[model samples]
Target: MARRTHKGEDDGTTSNNRLELIIEAAARMFDAKGYSATSTQDIANEVGLLKGSIYYYINSKEDLLFRIIEESHEGALRAIATVSHLDVGPLAKSYALVTTHVKVFHDDRVKHSVFFKEFRSLSDNRKEIIRGTGHAYSLFLRSILEEGQQVGQVDKALNPRMATAGIVGMLNSMSFWYQDGGSWGPENIGSQFAEQVVLGLVSEEYLLSSGGRKVLLETIRGELA
Candidate 1:
């Protein structure tokens, strides 16, 4: 049997189907045309609605931009939050981070790409909101590195904060080029990325051993201590 999202009429919010369709269309158009090149009318046409009707669901084009970026960041935050309080150490936190982050991009290619690529197109105020969300997400990633450094698990030569930003920058770029149903799905890419990052931060001995269990344990302990 088909499940129903609405059991009755007059639910405070309309069915997500309409809003989702609009967002999905906006994501594709923005990705294809660049945010500046894509207009509310374009989104409206794509979704078979009058331009004004878009306002019924969202305030304006900028509002849509905010929604897209906010939603994307929120998704990433949820993933990060999952591991934020985990009993595992920083190294394992990082592994889980990569896995979850990559999965978000793979799950919603269009929305993820917009957040990665078109966020700057938002108005200044909207950009600030997005930036705040982005900063919060970055902090979680940085904390892992900082903890790793403390534990002697990660190399002291690296700056935890800067390294976190760099790794995120690298992974965020994945959405720009990653193809769905490609040879590498989110899981494979996440695993590969996790391995690459762990190697870069941990001792060469750990890198050589493949599983890197020893180095990971050391890193976490150092961080916890």
Candidate 2:
């Protein structure tokens, strides 16, 4: 059980700002020192609050963690929602999905990092809630892959369900290894990832058409504006 430090006290901060502070602080603490290792006092101290002040904004640390995970998916889901409205082909649409995910994963990376590492800690009840959101995201990817299969762009033999799992597993695993800075930005990293997955998914005929593949990738992989 998590230790109770003290009773909550009023700090006179506005309700909204104080809550935001707690959420952001908790994400950082979770990122820096795994969730199980982090404490209410750690978050309170980070926010310059009394030990119990955190409880004023949230019932428990796990609730805060759940909130973070939910927010982490919000941006990406919204981005993916936009993909359906695009005029692009399956391959370009695939690139958009991958690139949007890359940018979202990196944009609020701390929350995402905590999301990947700490998701298992959620109670089964809460896990079910989060799993709903996860399923929606997975379905988006699967639909695009299935569309590619229909168009003969993706290999007819490919299994969209299994491929979605593999791709999501690969992308989520990056949370453990990808660093904030290096030669690559989200665009480069996302592009390279898209290139690899798209290549593997391409049908033999599609892969053989050098001009077709080259032209499409160059067009879709540009700034997503």
Candidate 3:
């Protein structure tokens, strides 16, 4: 694909750094204000760049939006990729996935908030690309649920696809009510949410050891850590 940068644009770290700065500022503004309502000038002002400088890197506002959404998904996918091959039971893998998902969700709330809410603003081609990323998430989580069922770790009666949707819905909803600097940090929230997910899946065997699941969780988490 052709480069978006202008022909005479400097191929230096400074240009790259400025592009990063613009994207970061744009994410914040787009989250605060709808993408349709934000302009390149507003982004430039937010980044302390001249209005023309935005054109130096991006061809249009949607270009910036596309970059932000893709970047957030890329960050999350990379993080979760580490958990895919963990030599642990499906239940523990599910727990780790939830925590990792939530952590990545909030690692930059501004950026990811735009990701979860504003993806529809992209062009159809770009929208398909974003949807592909989303489908990967569904496959990853659904596979874990399916594996757990097969191994008797999760309830065999549960529908893996529906279970995947329920868990993902609950985690995504956190973005709506979650506040920065809340009583709990990402790790704590992730653990609590992950525990709920694990507990919901185990009704008989896991409950016998008792609801604490603390010992089990600690062992799994320690290995993961």
> Which residue pairs clash within candidate 1?
151-222, 151-223, 153-219
- Candidate lDDT values, in order: 0.76, 0.83, 0.83
On TM-score, the stronger of 1 and 2 is: 2
Best by TM-score: 3
Backbone clashes for every candidate come to 3, 0, 0
Per-residue lDDT of candidate 3, residues 93-150 (tens digit): 9888888888888887787889878888999999999889878988988888888887
* Sliding window of 10 residues with minimal summed lDDT for model 2: 2-11
As a whole number from 0 to 100, the lDDT of residue 103 in candidate 2 is: 86
**Residue by residue across 1-225, what tens digits does model 1's lDDT show?**
743333222243554787888888887888788888899999988877777766667777877777777888888888878879778766678877887789887777778788778776777887887788788889888888889888766778888888898789878889767888889888889878876777678745444553456655456445544
Candidates 1 and 2, the one with greater lDDT: 2
> Model 1, which residues run further than 4 Å from truth?
1-16, 204-225
RMSD (CA, Å), candidate 2 to true, equals 4.6
